[model samples]
Target: MGIRDFADYLGISDRAISNWEAGGESYRPRAASQSVLDTGLARAPDEARARFADALGVSGPGPSAAAEMSVDSHKFLPVFIGSDRAHRLRTQMTGETPPDWLESCSAIVAHPHAPTCTLHVFACGVVVFHILQPRKPASLTELAVWRYRSYASDLPWARAKIHDLLGEHHPHGPNPEYVLSLYWLTAGPWIGSQYDTAMRLLSTPSVLVDRSAPGGPVPLDGAVEESLLATGFDHPDIVSFGVRGVSTGYAGWSGVSYAALSQERSLTVEELVSCELIVQALWCYTHHIQQRIEEGSDPSTPDRYGWRFLRAANSRLTTARAQETAQHCLMREAIMRTSGLAERLRAAQEALRESMG
Candidate 1:
């Protein structure tokens, strides 16, 4: 921040700031001013804190080491394309070789909304669209405001892309329940353990920031960050999928994942996205049946997605496979419990049984 901006932020004079700068270690502000400075440090965006730490010769995870050297936003929209469509697209689109452990491959696709978007096709019936938007946020607060404002329109844009992709490629495939979102944060100004607070707020944006303000939501500045720091933040629906320090994130019913560092992330992005795809597709499928029960009609789907299909999905999702990590298992279970996927599946199963009887 510039000198004047810093002064205005602290509710003080620019000249006083100049004197403090000139005085260096010799001049210390009075008690009230010291309190204000402390709040400024606490409430300032992750970037400002990073620079402050850098100036003080304290080193940590600053965004300077990143390839971009600036903050960027990653948005993912995943849908189910099933095995057959995934195969067809694999042949149609030229893609880089997949990692031996991964059954997924991605390719750049023409998108009307975002030029830098790519389509990731997973062997297990899921496809995700990844969009990258470059931005220079002055503070985490500024970024928070932008996220709340832009998300209103982003869902529709993704839905349009999915509609087009399916219309042209997989007409008979099951429709996506919703264009659910998952966010990844890369190269932010936040340093040290501050990334923890940043990730919590990012994962559940509505907790600290009031997004319901009349003239659109505005950041409460230090009040926002300070409150979270003091009381902590948690929501039953939001699941923390990654570890705390090396890399961090949470996946929730509201959104899939929000993380600070892209490197050595605790949970693979593929697992989180695939988990969401299965959960939401099942959620949508069961909802269709539940609605039919509500309307006094017997519900039915193509034999492929019938009761047996749900039974296999339940076992596949609930059972532990040979090589699954505990973290991956925990994340999948948390998503199922929080989203009520298991409950929905049982309810749908019962309804189907009664109709068949």
Candidate 2:
């Protein structure tokens, strides 16, 4: 959209728009004007939004026909710190008790630096940090691009935060990597059969976003669904975990993502977040065991969190309770498979069992 056209679309004067643009990156939009800009972006046509996002040099929302979807981003950073270290760290943290699912397995603490960040210290010698960033993205492609672009900063932030949280208790700490991500899609633009397509693309953003671009990430094409519909798209990492139309989700290696679409009943955000916590914690736990085996060492932990704990965790993850909703089970399994937790759990269980012998 041209300057005057965009100004008129926003129902604002051209000179004001010019001033804002002339101010460029340094220009901070007035606090009150932020809502106005947000409203304008929300009401703008998909085509115009795409153009705007492209001009900003980022992967944009979906194609012209695709509706804008609201997504709140969640980042999971998991690392192993050993059971003894986790116990010592908990004494330094002032946080609430964890939920029922994680109460026995892990200790939940708030990240001191970032309000939106929380740290989960598991008894199994792994810690997962949960960072929440609310976003109104046009498409999963935008999220994929946003995630990678910020990863450089996110990793360093996690490392520093860990050191601060652990204090001088331990001089050595394991490096934490980007374990996974989740998007609680509050409002979806797709309908009926389109849910499958959205879930598929959500699992694999590389399909539309080009992450290897010169400057930063950009969209591969203006239209995603059209191209996907033509040839059909699927990824081994993508796992569908919801019924059609009602509630749909996809879990992939990068993250577990879900959208609540049920009219009769909707799954709570707390429910989804809790599931992600379990998935991420388990992924971290298994990664520690895997790392030990690779280093040619027998995994060892306190008696309570030894081979028996792995067996119990495996059952907790692989088994589905009757009271839980189908969506819950589907999402859990999807995350498990995508993270390769099941395989790792099995291997860990066997290795630890042999150690016991």
Candidate 3:
């Protein structure tokens, strides 16, 4: 088929089809578009299919379009943990009896900075943790550390903040019931907030003082080197060190990955601890806001209404302080969502005020 005919057949823009035909190193069909292309090839005449497949450099319709096109799924295998193992770990970390519903839960660890690290605790006690990464894959140990830290340290602060803001007898410390309830309500936005925080930190400019380079500290974008400086991160064995914007091959997600020259050193414990605190704080604040929305007591409030089902599963309390907390949460979310440089700066200023007060 001609480009226009193929575009029409695939129900996509002709430009996209043209990009596909041009066979550039970066162009690839979208996942949905790829599926359509595969289906069209499957139904095409054998000769036509062979021509199209040859143009795209694929064996046939059976293989992934990513192979023919310069597409990447950014997919990774999940580290599965049975409910019993998760519960035992939780108990060991927090010294609390895990909720009965934890028996069917599984944890997935992906890229630490990716917003995909989120927990979903079902009413029946089944929890699924989706861990995503921006560039490299995360190990099971890294995932476990994040989980343990969230439960042991982050959860208590979240609970206390909620109780203090709402002026309720909410459970204190890392009680599994309260923790799970809170996660169920706030995990989505909280996870996003954590990712935003990491990105913000990564975006900061910094100098990498490579010992091998006698020329003094070299300047680089902090975002690329932030992952390298992270604890337990193994430096990629490649020798290349430069920045290039690469397509993640996934729609709506694209960024630059830094190729850093490997050094024989790692981030200090204090530096790692500081970075972890920033991440933990973002999650805590978001959780606080989610809790306030739940405790707003007015079903008409949009945030509260949206989370009604989750609220129903947990205790409800309301107060003037809780409303104020909701306002702060809204402000934080707004700051995270801001786009323009000036707008973001203003949002950050306002966030400072919110945090101080």
Candidate 4:
């Protein structure tokens, strides 16, 4: 349920409930509020408080608050082997143990308002939360509109400070989760490559999401990309710019494959750490792509069998110095935009203050 529904049940304003969900404010529910949720849900007090805090984005009132908030629920999902649920779910779902740091994982905090539900795990003193959001197809018109708006919003600020400082904007897909789900798939080289390639693909506003039909592996030159590009999607290969790019495609597949993977395992500490690097790589690739696209060049290979060309293109984009330069440019542009807007806004505020005086 959304925050408003919970607030109404508790005789509080929606904002109050929102604050509790977001936490860290003076209004963050303390012991008393924890009691209300516990008694209302008839669940374990700790689980309830943790859920409350999680739904609100707060760390509940520590262990004591959890002690008071316990209750029980009858629903049960089969405990599978090699899964975190086989261990923690019974305790959490039954309100037996104090909730682990899963409720407070960084994935949840970073993507607090994501539409899809998430699963979090705590191992070795680190929290790794997996985010799962459904992916949808985009029409070419949708792509154009998305590209226009994304470029408009991101480029204005980018232009105010540094050149080539474009932001990644998805006009036609699901909402941009604050922390994109790059950690959900296989970790290591696959993750790294996908991270790097997604950045490169984003540079040209290409449709990076794969939507082949449900039959045998869908054709790469299918309707989805054509629909997104309005023209035949010019590329070296249908899958991974051709077979060589499959490693790159593997990364994209992993980034968007949280659902299939979620059923198999919980997010690990190493995965989260790797995801940060992957995302940074993505940001750098996107910036580089944006710069080239703005100048009317395709960042991916021109021919379908152009792995060598794509590889060289990929190499130029992944060098540490290149990535760092792109980051500096984006940050510099953001600062300049902030400063300019602050100046104008301050002037307007001063004029009002003087008029009132």
Candidate 5:
């Protein structure tokens, strides 16, 4: 049985089980040898032995208490703060409880199964404990535990990013939006590659925004949209990976742009649209050439088909001399066909002029 079940059977706390598993004491299935039972088994020995055997689901007698028990410290670490927090909080809970590592920060945020304390580590590897206050609901620890599992299984670089992110600062307050964004920037590839994991992260507390707050920044709707779009563009194989879902990585990016756009000198939609068109044209032309190069032939190699297609596409686009002529022609024709659009444009111009006055 696991240490948790054993702890329940012995009527001891899980921490105590951790401590026992660490060293100072030893425990065994009571139904060992008849001689050792008389020596080591504590209190109402026969009854305790039967209870222990029943609790462990073992029918027959096991080894004596005198038999060497392998109490692994490494194994106990994961059970305590979990694999993610183990390396971070090890000294505070188990190893040499360093004086420098102790810092009075917060209260114990206990999981039903295992209590946890958050700590910061200094450059010298000294840990400073800042226990988190318990949440009213039990899901807080469950969330942490789930993240612990997910984050632990990440690539080494991704794990480092998660550690750096969580360890950096919490005093800035409940900025889950920011945290989620950082994860995207640093560990997005891993999260995006898996649909379920990416969706789970999105549903977490950090990504969700409070809409009712007055004077808050523009909602993260755009960033969320963009993120999901990026994921779809990059990882269409999420379904083949046994996860079926679509997600956006755009929300996080749009969230970041909130502060900038809210400030003075933001670009108008027309300007933005123009910029997007240019970028799109560039991307199409670049990708066409890149795909040809990536497929087989080198750029240095003369490709009759590629060069011919490229020249034709380039010829259709305007030269510097034709730019004004082309614009004049299009505007004259558009004015003749779309008088309503011209009226709306005039109204928008008048509104802007009136607002400035």
Candidate 6:
């Protein structure tokens, strides 16, 4: 029935029915009036019933409607870390225990059924700990255990690689390149892509040198120049190695330089372990930033600990663009799911009306 007909049938004014149909906050029907309309709709003609259902935003049968709902209707998982580990690390670093809240962050990583994305966020927390308190690098080991315990079945190879790396001893020190390769293997495809892209951006010649001087080459700091050289790009022509210019030879050179020169490999085995930990931590940091962006949180917002580790890593790799890309990807998935759900609902409602008729 039309709104006017329904209003007359329910003993209400047409304007009141119009207000209910419009769904304006100021004109919400009382429970009795709403129940009266529901009863009328329940007994109405098929076409009129469908029309009223549409006006009321009732898409289809409740069960079917719920089944077709999108990810937008579900809450995203929160980023979590091990509170006990975080507190222990904090205590080790500061010679005092952390606050209660800081010590009470959920131990999401240890939970066997935690989502993979949540585990990634926990990995980032481990990285943050490594950066903020290098003296307490045990978090990385804990992260490895968490990852293995939580995802061993799905990511068996990654867990195996972690075991091999941690269990085996390297006399010459674990090659930074080798450690990084393992990280890429375990980090999943998207994170590996982000790391490669970030590395390429850092290695760009224009980024390394002064832009204004076409003739005169800018002198880079010794370490910066060394790192660039290690990437196999000649000083002035480094721009030739664009975003997709990653190479194994360059990786080896860079890895060795990072391990030997940057980290100073004295105890070879420990140095290798340290190299793996550092690379994994950096990747985790990148993932953390991406997770924050997807959660609709401000990526740059200051936190309790001021995100010292994230800031330090970003200073070197500049994860802003990569994080933006991740955010866009998440939004696209949500939009696609929403669109799909709407289409499915429309189809289901049409089918329902056809069956009713």
Give one clash count per candidate, in the order shown.
3, 0, 2, 16, 14, 0
RMSD of each: 15.7, 16.3, 21.9, 26.0, 29.6, 25.5
What are the models' TM-scores?
A: 0.60, 0.72, 0.22, 0.21, 0.17, 0.22
Candidate 6 per-residue lDDT, tens place, 1-357, comes to: 588876788777899877776986767666566455444543456676456446645422221112121110001122223233334433433232244222222211232332321111122234121111111112222322322232223243333332342354444321221112211111111122333332332223234444345543443344553453345334322221110111111122112111111111111323323333334444433444445556765444224323443344333332223322222222222222322323333333333334334
TM-score of 4: 0.21
Global Cα lDDT for candidate 1? 0.63
* Per-residue accuracy of model 3 over 182-289 as CA lDDT, tens digit each: 010001111212322222222221222222335533433344444544522222221211111100000011111111111111112222222222222223323433
In order, the Cα lDDT scores of the candidates are: 0.63, 0.68, 0.30, 0.30, 0.29, 0.31
Can you write out model 1's per-residue Cα lDDT over 1-33, one digit (the tens) per residue?
Answer: 799998999889999899888988978876556
Q: Write the per-residue lDDT of candidate 4 for residues 1-357, one digit (tens) a residue.
A: 678786777666788676775765554455556445433443234465446446643332211221121111010001011123223332343323245312222222223323533233222111223333322223222322333333333323322211111122434211211232231223212132333342223323335332333431222344554353333332332122111111122123112211111211122334333333323322322333344446775544223212332243333333333223222222222322322322333333333234334
Please, what are the lDDT tens digits per residue for candidate 5 over residues 1-357? Answer: 687885565555678657545664454422322222222222334566457546544422111111221110000010111223434544344333235211211123222232443333322222223222222222222333333332223223222333453474333321111111111111122222343333333333233333344643223444553474345332221111000111122122111110011111222223322222222222223333344445664332123223343333233322222323222222222222222223333333333334334
Using TM-score, rank the candidates from best to worst: 2, 1, 6, 3, 4, 5
- Top model number, lDDT: 2
Which candidate do you rate higher for lDDT, 1 or 2? 2
Better of 1 and 6 by lDDT: 1
Off by over 4 Å in 2: 1-67, 96-115, 168-172, 191-195, 212-218, 223-226, 229-231
